[model samples]
Target: MVKDREQNSNKEKKLLVSLIWNFSTELKLILMALLVIFTLATLLPFIPSSFSLSASDFRFCISRLSSVNTTTTTPTKLSPENNTTTELVLDRVLDNGVIKRTFTGYGSAAYNFVSMSAYRGGVNTFAVIGLSSKPLHVYSHPSYRCEWVPLDPTHDPVSTTGSKILTDWGYGRIYTTVVVNCTFPSTTTPVGGNLILHATTGDPSLNLTDSIPVLTEPPNSVDLTLYTSSTKKKQYDYLYCGSSLYGNLSPQRVREWIAYHARFFGERSHFVLHDAGGIHGDVFEVLRPWIELGRVTVHDIRGQERFDGYYHNQFMVVNDCLHRYRFAAKWMFFFDVDEFMYVPEKETISSVMESLEEYSQFTIEQMPMSSKICYSGDGPARTYRNWGFEKMAYRDVKKVPRRDRKYAVQPSNVFATGVHMSQNLQGKTYHKAEGKIRYFHYHGSISQRREPCRHLFNDSRVVFENNPYVLDTTIRDVGLAVKTFEMRTIGNRLLRTRQ
Candidate 1:
């Protein structure tokens, strides 16, 4: 009876195996599909109805459940902040002990906070803020007293009193910005910098502490509270404030740009590179040398992308850079990495600027160089051997009408700065910069990583548009000089190129 039962079980097992084999992969696939569908069905109900899922996101989920899928996805509207309400993005402590906080505040009033910085300027202590918001109630807290007191509350902030929007220029920004200034009582000392917030006047929300500079007269009375300025020795003569650099940028181009600028500007020059997304992959390696030399400082501002502000929060970037280094540099140049600031031959940039010390701000004229057009020696094959400028020798000589301009400024005189020029300040702007200063713009070339030279021109008959391409080998020669300088200074071992 036991043997008979065993035979019957073996026969049944064989029959099942035969059925599966005859159906080919159909049976197996159907079972797997059903399993995946069931699993996704279980998870689908748990996910929130309002959760946003892009096409790519759905593709990712499908890949995870590759055998089959059943999850029903519903898209939701997301603000610049990843979260719905009141998300704090950046809370960085500045080098001078002032704390800079950036938040995605809760509102639909179109009013938003960018940043507020408080520092002692000469005899008075003042706060300079860049934002588009309600009249902020300013508060100052002395370390000794350990209390927050209103500086300018119920005051006529509506009227102009050392307060103005740096510039009312933005590319369809959700929150429009203006400059709001309030002075702290000179008698009181701060633990950190002064606290300025947007709330009902005199009603403080959150309290935080920081350290600032102390006074020698009242040593014991005023402790180290709001120290926002560096000593004279730590200051720089020249500072470069870059815009929000984003997208796929050429690593080698970035390398050449930094090396060339550093070489051109000499030592005493510092570059503030705000990386929105561009500084990735080998780009970091390219900048690592300058960063080590203290010539370059890269800000990882990728978080600002979520905010639907004017071109990756460009205004805020310039303002932050200006305020952060307001006391640091004697002269600051606000421009782009793609735009190379150039002075005429035999004239040092310092000397060129020294001549125009009377002016508070000076704009640099743009030399729009063609990316496709190049001046080649012997019709060389397309190769990444030479730098972009070294190969790209043609610049359009035709004068085009420009609405915007890049500028250099004395940040101390600048209350707030915009993308093009700093207007809300103390002195005259020098618009007549003809032979002294200008920038070489390899238009849309920074975005090109590999091949810079699209076409080589041996003749002057090349006409892409009405703009005439001339054999301006000025910057090209400079590129060669930059290469030589790099080899001499950086050496062969520390440097590496991708051919």
Candidate 2:
């Protein structure tokens, strides 16, 4: 038995040695190949540049895995949560120098990969990396206020073929100036003059050429322009309010919700605040500019209506008028200021609109909103370390009983007394989507000193329970009383009631 065990140990050692040898050999080969490729890339600057390639064709990768399909069983094809992010690190060795790095990564993920290069006279410095992906849409980042002007293909009217190019201006605070260069490719045609550029941020129809002059350069395939003013950068169309004002809510938590909500809606979407109780002035002051330009607008309605000073309601209203409000936008969602919506399969609000365009109205898919009830005081200063729902002053509101349900049927009312339900309905058909295809109800987590908001039921998919005194109650289904603040998280549904 001892001899056999010794033999087995020797065999394992041999296998391990062989595996190590093979791995080393593979690593050496990879390094050698990378070195050869780098040498060839170094010679690119000398190869008399070609001006025949179209701007679109200049983009390197469009692998077979990047296309959208309705026939495939997998609904989520390319979500940021599931896919690997392609990151490019830009390092600066000198105090005042620029670097430009150009390498291609897969683009089918929401945004396109970026190629950045820094320059100092004849010497090419370090190149940093960035993206123009779906989530990082429009090539703009908080680090730099980049601007893109997409070229229009329909300028000539008489000619069928046209070219497109996007210009970017780095953030103004850190970077003193922004430079734009339009270049024709080595594989396509000489695209010049007749190109049109438009800004899609605030006014999608706002043409930049009407306000400024577009200088036309040479046939060498490079046209250069620059923008120096930092304050004039483009911003999103909706207001983005910080949950920091929600008192106890952490900034990190708010960031997660923001990222999830932004991606779920459509990559470059913005948000605004509607603090009904008016406890947070800082959040409003910070997001003021977006409000002024209508790029991001807030609707503060604290004193708009008061219900015996016991409760107030806060909600967000998004006006997506830039994207053909009639077609691109089919319906409006009215959710509690705390609640958010997320759909499965990388499905965006625009994509869903396309799917529901066939039907006139539909029910939104519902997710139950929940959180640990705190036992401490109602103010933000209260700590939840020892507090638990069992010791709290308030109990989870219940659904009301049948009768006295007339107050629930008003069309203007968007939320039920309890948790509200939703369906992605078109005509009469209703079906359940995955939790990935869900909306979030985040009220429970954001309780302030005065209770920031009351429930609202504005979507077409909801109806109230059949009880009158049951206001602020929670019901998982229809035919119950309305209760106050029952459904705090996702997946809860409000039943319909008739007047």
Candidate 3:
């Protein structure tokens, strides 16, 4: 009887276990079905809606978020003042200082960009250059305060291959640049010569006649800076090489260039020699005296290795006398030696710039400038295959014709957008205004046009009709310019015709 009872109890326990197992399995299956439904719900946003989202929509969302953050948070005060030169602060973002250095004046406020590491390439050399409008007595000129040091013969590295030497100047300051090819290269044999030394901070004690020591070191890199007093504060000017290779201007040529620049700027402005490559030493030596006699100090800015092509055009500086003494100037012109973009007005560059400054909204300082496509004018200007570099040409401030080129100017577009022909602007739009300022771009002769004219060209904020104003001007002249006489409309229309 007892065994039979135990058997029955075991049978009951087995039955209960079977029931629990079946219940749990069914629950798991139901859960999995629910999970699938939930997943589909989660992915619903990705399914195409009646109105599709666009790339610009995403950008707009990001912009909105950024704007919100900006509006919600107040920027903390920086530990050190960057705008004003006071006591120096170490290990802080030189944001304002870097901005001041990169963009010199009024329109700089419109530049909405940031940079890190003021000299990522490296600023190892410092040099000081002095320029005198009137010839100064080398013995007594107050501007002769800087020193030119000779490359140390015994300490320099030795090599037998042609090499270049770079140096740094300045005790340690913001004005630093890289000077290239200042040292003698190592050849199969070492040649020694007396290298003339220039003094920094007026060291009368420097040995004036020390031969630059022969170096066996393969040419390395260097950086430099320059400093000078403002003797003629109203007549100060500085020349910076746009793409290096500025050592080629001859002395007589230098004088003539100075005279030309002086006439152009209405002050004593001239070109100052900096550093140069081996192929250009003859021109370098000719201009070295002006650098040595406290007239000009050459600065060598380090460039990236990528720019191994196009050594044809370089930049030289020109400005009113006040540019040197005061760090402010009316206009800063950057053009290649082969290219000159002349304004079509009798007003000084400063007056033109001021006109823009007074009229421009803080956000967009760059006024649209139309280029007067000058041809060689050797023959009937119209018959030529576009204008070559030699012909001085001008266009009516109304419209531009169509063009077919790899790169076309943008009609109604600022000169910075496209070149040769105008860009098409069918669906885009921009903010615009009719103001006091005007822009005229004189692209001399298409033959001398440089390649990759991207940075040199960019579209304006506004477009006309369904096409970009930078491409053609006919529509704008007929529609917009006639109504408002807005310079931008005319500018855009002229740019479009060239396209």
Candidate 4:
């Protein structure tokens, strides 16, 4: 009976020990599962919710978490104060390789349809578009096509060996050249097409598009030979400036402009004037001598209206001039009639060019001269005598850097041209002649029709009286010539009317 009792106690003790061991094993498994759940919760934010975590993914997450040094690092956060200065945040789409997020509020993305020309082979077309931002992709398609054709930097037989990429012009603007080949041949003078620009930023669903009404004909097909003279055939070492003149300008103002450039540039200068406005017979008569001498070539573009704004048409005229005299002239400048290229330090533009021989391209800073300095308390005559020759004596209301203003370039080096910048240069060396050369832009003095300059008055008291390159004799001579020409023209018109 005692042996049996001892045996029962031992059995009871063994059962108790087995039960405790099973409970402890179960508790350890439950704790391990809870620990795993906590780890997954911590890593949930980093991993995409749509992606299911496989064994490899879990391993990757574990390695990534292990590599992070949380103790030493601080979290990065974007705020308004550091938005402009901070590096832009970029995100890539998982399905499609597209940039979904980019720096915003920098500048608005915009583009203008410059011109389109038929390729030499006639199977392809060349299109030029001016943009305000760098676009991710550009597409061109015919009206009949349902799909958009991507434009690549393919070789262009017309402009250069390779298609011109987007060139930055500052102030949030760029210029891109695209080549579009027709899928099916159509017997049309100017092929109809549309250009779609996809920007690097913004809602991926939206894009900008412009119509290309006439792509077959080149923009320069206009009668460039209308004012060509025998003397123009000879290549000269001169700085030539071209401008597309629109609207009616005062006869005196016209003469003053022509004479000012003529006197300043001397014999080593030529002006190509595209008369988009109906210039008076008297003005033409005054310019007839210069026209015959090939010092000035005027093309009547009165009826040839292409673009909407006057500024848009100016780009076309600039491109036309660029192609027309690319080989004939050494250097070329594109700006408005009111603007003058002033080299304060050097005697002539050639001398300035000589100094900047190492650079293939140079931009001139624009100094906006106030109208108050243009005209004194007196009339236009006294204004010319006092401030006309002494333009540097006037105060500049605003000054724009060369990168933001008009430029001069070797015509051969530039593959494309813009109002304020040049694109696709052979050497691609652009130098800003900030202090050496200044573009003295005279506004509101003569052309009051311009809305922006209408309110500007001779009000500012600031003056640049210390400048030493005032051309008093040239101003007097040019002013006198203009007055004489006007007098003779009015007299002739009066005689004709009497007859």
Identify the candidate with maximal TM-score. 1
Best by lDDT: 1
lDDT of 4: 0.50
Tens digit per residue, CA lDDT, model 1, 15-40? 99999889969988999999999999
Stretches of candidate 2 above 4 Å error? 1-259, 267-273, 285-295, 306-329, 373-436, 448-499
From the highest TM-score down, the ranking of the candidates is 1, 4, 2, 3
lDDT of each: 0.67, 0.31, 0.29, 0.50
How many residue pairs clash per model?
A: 11, 69, 81, 1
lDDT of 4 by residue, 332-417 (tens): 77777767666664366667778876666777777665443332334445543432433323444333343247787777566567
TM-score of 3: 0.25
> Under the 3 Å rule for N, CA and C atoms, how many clashes does model 2 have?
69
lDDT of 4 at 350: 68
Model 3 residue 373 CA deviation (Å) reads 10
**After superposition, candidate 3 runs with Cα above 4 Å error:** 1-241, 246-261, 268-331, 353-499
**Residue range with the least summed lDDT across 10 consecutive positions in model 2:** 403-412
RMSD of each: 15.4, 27.3, 24.2, 19.3
lDDT per residue as tens, model 2, 312-415: 21111111111111111224333444454544445555675566544433444433333433223334343322111111222223353421100001111111
lDDT of 3 by residue, 91-120 (tens): 233546432222112222111111101110
